[model samples]
Structures are given as C-alpha cells and as structure tokens.
Target chain A: MRIWHGLLIALGLGVAGGLYITAPAPLDAGFASDHTADTEAGALVFAAAGCASCHTAPDGASEGPQVLAGGHAFASDFGTFYAPNISPDPASGIGAWDLPTFARAVTKGVSPDGAHYYPAFPYASYQNMTDADVADLFAYMQTLPASAQPNQPHDVGFPFNIRRGLGLWKVAFMPDGYVTPAPDDPVLARGRYLAEGLAHCAECHTPRNAVGALLTDQWMAGAPNPSGKGRVPNITPAALDWSESDLIEYFTSGFTPDYDSAGGEMVEVIENLSQLPEADRAALAAYVAALPPIPSP
Target chain B: MKRIFGLSLATCALAAAAFAGSHANPALEGAVKARNAQMSVIAYHTGLLGGMAKGDVPYDAATAVAAAENLASAAAMKRAVLWIEGTEQGAVAGSRAKAEIWSDAAGFEEKAVALEAASSAMITAAGTDLDALRAAMADVGGSCGACHKAYRGPKN
Candidate 1:
C-alpha cells in the first residue's frame, strides 16, 4: 500500500511538471526605445485602471498611500484579500520582475513568483491588452520612483488561501491569450479591447456566482456584489439613457446626460479617464455605445 | 446662462416615470428632483469647461475664476441632502452602492468633507495659468473620485 501511494504522488508531480513545460512560452517583448511614448501610454493605462484611487492615501494625508504601496482591503465571499504593492521596489514591489512576468500578471493573472492572483486585480479584463500596450505599460511602471513599503498579507481564510485551487479556477475562466482586434470590425475590436482590457467594465457590472466567479454570459448586465447591499446597475446600451457622444463626455468630465453628476466609484473612474488622451477616451465611448442593449435580467 | 432648461427635467421625469410611473413615492420624486438640480449645476460647469478646453471661449482669468467658483458652489450642496441617505442602498437593480454611507454616518461625512476640501482648492486654483489650472483640476477631479471610491454606485 505504501509503495502504491508513493507511486501515485510521483505520477501527480510528473503530470503537473509536464503541464508547466507544455504551456506556451512567455512572449519576449520590450517597449520601443522612445521613452516619451512609453511613459505616455503608461499614464493612460494607469488612469484607465484607476490605480491611484485605491493605491494612494486620501488628500493632505501624509505621503499618498505608498504609490503602489498596496494595502487596500477588498472584502469578498471567499475572504478578504489585501492588495499587494506593484511598485518597482526591489524588495516589496515588482522591481525585480522581468517584462514577461509583469505581462503575465496583468494579462494572465499569474504573478512573477508563479502565484495566482485573486480577481480583485481585474486581470480578466486586462487579458485583452495587446502585447505592445503591455510592453509600454511595463516600461511606464518601471519609470515610477520605487516605493519601499512591504506588502500586506491577505486575511483570506483556508481553502481560498490555497494557491493550487486558483489553478483550477484559471483553467476554467481565464482567457488563453490577449484580444486581437478583428480586421472586419474595427469598432467591435476597439470596444472589446477597451471593455475587456483597460476599463475592466465587467468587474463591477457583471454579477458573480456563488463561488465568486463572474457570470460571463451575463456580461455587463447588473449583479449583486458580496456586500449584499446595493446592486450594480445594468449598463448595456439598452439601460443607459446617454448617447455615444454624451457617454464620452460623461466619461471625460463626469457629467451624466441629464447633467446630473455621477458620484462614488464612477467619479474616480471619470477622474482617471479625464487624464487620458482624448482619442483613447473617444474610442472607449465608441465601443461602449456600440454594445448590444442587453436587457437586465 | 443660469436659466432653467426643461430637457434635463424632462429626462428625469421620464426616468422617474419609467422606474415606477405615476404611483412612485413623492419623497423619492422630490429627492430625485433635488439631485437633478445639483447635477444640472455640474452639467453647466462641464459646458464651460468644454468651452475652455476647446478654446471656444477666451481663457480670461476672471471668467475662468467665476466658472471655477460656480463649480465649487454647485458641488457644495451637502451630499447627504441631495440623495436621501438610504434610497440607493435598497435599489432593485444590482447596485454596488453600499448602505455603509448611511450606517456609518461619520465615514460618509468624511468623504463629503474630502470632496469639499478638494473642490475648494480647485476654485482657488482655476484662475491661474494653464499648467496650474490643469494641476488644480486634477486635484479637484481626484477629490470627486476619492469619495466615490467608498460610496457611489459602480460604473455600469
């Protein structure tokens, strides 16, 4: 019996090792030598993701919460997960991460150390980022002055804390590669990238199932969050009353079609988006305006 | 240009009607009306900002300063007064707006205070040079978000 058990363990290890070896080789790419463009692109991504809102401490407060000095807590069904610092700090942040590792985390949900990240980081949407865009983003991040604050350990409980379980989740839900714009439909392709990559609209719009998995088929249809408090509204073109130009304007300036202001999380998104180049903001509006007016469930 | 336009009111009325039609709560209607009024002010300011951004209007320091002051005043209505405290928490559609804003009164007040503080700074800075204006705008913009991070409904 003992011999058989030992053989089973060895077989399992071999299979896991085999799977790792067969996986696609992480792509090798780098930002163009033009420092200016890379930095500009980086700023855009930062705004799109609203990185500063969560990462930074509130105003007049000492140093803005360590730039990338992640310690923000997100309460969810599985457990509480504290955000980790992604600054270029060698000791705490991703300072030592190679380009591919950063790409993998942003686009593939896998960290440089081979650990799986919780969806709170929104890599699912980020999976649509193009390689060139990711390269530029990586370079931009590298340029930020490093933050030395150490990471905050997640308060997640057992089972959820097991990194191996995330492997199963990834296999089931993770998109295999970045979204490529279809040649036939530039609008859709652009929308797909903006929605799926930069905006990560579904993170808040789509409802999660019992295990906290996103109900992808529902798409932007509204769903209740773990908070069990307020429900995220249905944002498919159908539910929204704003026109494309109006939506674009709102995103750029935070004004609703009725000229009433959007508050809360949207305000931050608007703030972040306001800083983006106008072209990108327009593209996002174009794509969102084109979504099927999916009815609320 | 402070003249009332009926389009927003019409839209809000339509939206209210669509939500529950004639039988809706008068209190909720009143609240929505108040919210709409404040939002209109924000919209008006946004229009001025648009003109400034496009260089359609001259970037006169005085007018720019006035526009910025209008923005600050418009933002000042006690946020708690605008939307009835608990109305958003019980919304039917899946909304990420938390009940915490009402339950944890102190925290909610803090968010409002933060927004107010930032808005004030923006008003002070708007009449300055373009670079200064942009930086102040960024701060003002960021203040609007800082509060939203904890309180507002998620972007659909």
Candidate 2:
C-alpha cells in the first residue's frame, strides 16, 4: 500500500511539471513594416462588424456608447446577456489572448481557455469568416486603447451556468470549417458572408427551439420577441409584398411602404448598412431577395 | 379634486384657442422658427407617450393627458405658420418636411387638422373610459402615419 501511494504521488508531480512547461506564454506578436497595410484594411472590417454598439453602454443618450467599454444588454426569450468588454486591457479584456486563441474563439466558438462560448455571441455567423479577415480584426483590436473595465458575470440561471456542456452542443451544431463563397458567384457570396456572419440577421429573425438553438430548417422565418412587438417578418422570396428593388431601397434608406419605416432593433441594422459602400448594400439586397423561399406548409 | 383639474384643463384649452387666433408674429421667418421648435417638442412628446403605451417604461394617465393636450395645441397652431410667407421652407430639417406642403397647402392643412382632432379625441378618451382610449390611440397612430406618409421623409 505504501509503495502504491508513493507511485501515485510521483505520477501526479510529473503530470503537473509537463503541463507547466508546455503551456504557451502570452502573445508578443510584433507589428512590423508590412502589417501596416493590413491594419488599415482591418479598420474597415471592424466597422463592418458594428462592434461598437454592443460593447458601448448607452447611458441615456440618442447615439450608442463608446467602443469596447462594454455595457449593452441583449434581451432574448432565454434571458438577457450583457456584452463583455473586448478592449485590449491585459487584466480585464482580450489583451492577453494570442492570435490562435482569438481565431479559435471567433471562428470555432471556443475561448482562450479552451471552453466553448454560447452561440449568442454569433460565432455561428462569424464561423463563415476567412482567416485573413479574422487576422485583420485581431490586428484592429490590438490598436484599440486598452480599457480596464472588468466583465460582468452572465445573469443566466441554473443549468445555463454549466458552460462545460457547450462543448458537446458545439460538436453537434457548429460547422467544422469556415465557408467560402463560390468564385463564380462573388455577389451572392459577399451577401452570404455579410448577412450570415457579420450582420447576424438570423439571431433575431429565426425561430428558436426550447434549448434556444435556431430551427435551421425554418431559417429567417418570422418570429416574435419577448417584448410583444410585431413578429420579425420573413425576408425569403415568398414575401410577396416586396419587389427586389423595393428590398434594396429599404436596406439603403430604412423605409418600408406598408410598415412605414424600420424602428426599434432594425433601426440599428439600417444605420450600419447605410454606412457601407452602396454596392455592398445592393449585393446584400439582391442575394436576399433571390433566396428560395421555404414554401408555406 | 377632479373637478378642479378638469376646469384648469378647459381653461388651458380656451387659452390655446386664443393663441391660435392671434397669428401676428416676428414675421414669416420667426413664425417658421417658432413653429418648427414647437413641432419638435410635439414629436418628442409623441415618442414619450408611445413609449408608455408599449409599457417599455412607466407612465401616468394625467401626464399622458397633458402631453396629448400640448400636441393637439401645437398641431392647431400650424395653420398660421403654413399661411405665413416662407415658413414653408422651414419644414426641411424637421426631416421629411416636404416641399409639397406649401404647394398642396390645403392637403397639408387637412392632415394637420386630422392630427389635432385625433389628439383632442385621445385627451377625451383618457378622461372617460379605457375602451375609448384604445380606439383613440389607434386614431392617433393612424393620423401620425398618414401625415408622415405624405409630408415626412421616408427615413422615419
């Protein structure tokens, strides 16, 4: 018995030593001469994501708050999840994360600590991003002034706190690889990337199951929010009220003839799209209007 | 207590009528400036009331009544401004303020009158019954939408 106990202790010590030695050190990837051009392009990608609206708290004002300061409340049928501070502060934010860890988190819904994050973070959409775009986003984040704001713990109840279960869930739901639009279909592909990944339209528009997973078979079908507002309408081709050009104009200017104008949550979407290059908006509209409608049951 | 509140509101309504009748001002430009400012406040109050109606926040019936009254009074005042020389040009920054407001002057007047009428109906509805309040609310939203469709910019 004494010999067995001694062996166990020796084995534990060896394992600990191996882990300590093999663990990566914090990232020190320096930005040298060539990275400058990439950084400028990265800035546009950052704007495309509209990262500022969620990160910044609206403290009783008309416009959204400062980028990366982190105080927006996202309300859903499940519960409200506050946005976290993503600024480059070493102690309170993503400053310590290495490039590989950031890429995994953004693309695979995994965190720096090797834990899976909730899809509420829109990793499903972001999973479609190209590696180079992901790299640029990281570079842009590095350029941001470090904010030392600590993250608030999520207000989820009971089993929701068991984040480890996300590992299994991710394996079932998340795609293993990033998507690339077909080379011959540039316009449609660009629209798909922007709508599925960056804009995250399905998060609000798609019907959800009891576990809060999206009902992919009914993607973009209209669904009601907890606030009891009008249901988010289907944008599929079967929505007979809208023409292709009408859809394009609505995205560009936020006016819908029957509904009057986009308000509440959609107002932010319009504001984001309004700032994009006109051609990008046109492409998005064209692709969306061309989608094969899930025929009425 | 309710009697005194009713009397005070009646007195204010009559005073608004007096103000509406006296069209004299610092001339066309000044009239337009004052009307635009007044209309902005009206629009802001509508937002506040709509927020309450949706229960996104808290509100009181008395406050709602007061807001509705002020908006009604402002809508009534627009006729004078519309008739004033170039007060027509002042509608632009208030966004969706159409140039056609001056050209189709009679149509614009009709919409403004409809809004004032809806506001008064809403105030009366709030004073008496919940059923009436619901009907009046629909009217108010419709009148705003109708006017916005015609004169306001598509960006609303």
Please provide, for model 1 over A1-297, each residue's C-alpha lDDT reduced to its tens digit, 9 standing for 90 to 100.
999999999999988875774343354454233333476777777777666666653331423333676777777887777777778899888899877778888877777667777777888788777776777778777776677877888888888787767767777666554333353567566666777778787888877777667776677788775555567778877787666667666676565554445565677678778877767777777777766677887
Using all chains and alpha carbons, the TM-scores for the candidates as numbered come to 0.67, 0.58
TM-score of 1: 0.67
DockQ of each: 0.18, 0.03
- Give the alpha carbon lDDT tens digit for every residue of B73-139 in model 1: 8777866445443346345233345677666768778767765676677666667765556455445
Docking class of 2: incorrect
lDDT of 2: 0.63
Model 2 ranges with Cα > 4 A deviation: A1-37, A60-65, A175-184, A226-228, A295-297, B1-156
**Model 2 chain A poorest ten-residue lDDT run:** A24-33
Would you list the clashing residue pairs of candidate 2? B96-B152, B96-B153
B15 Cα displacement, candidate 2 (Å): 11
* Highest TM-score scorer: 1
Estimate, for each residue in B1-156, the C-alpha lDDT of model 2 and write its tens digit. 867865665465445445546553234435456766765766665655554543444656787778778867876773542444333333323333566776786877887788789888878775554445545654565555556656654433
lDDT tens readout by residue for model 2, A1-297: 999999999999977765554333332244222343376666656666666657754552334433485767776665677888888888877899877778777777777775667777878777777667778888888887777877877777767666766655565565443233343578887887777777777777777777777677766766666455556767776663566555554564454533244555565566567567767777778667766686422
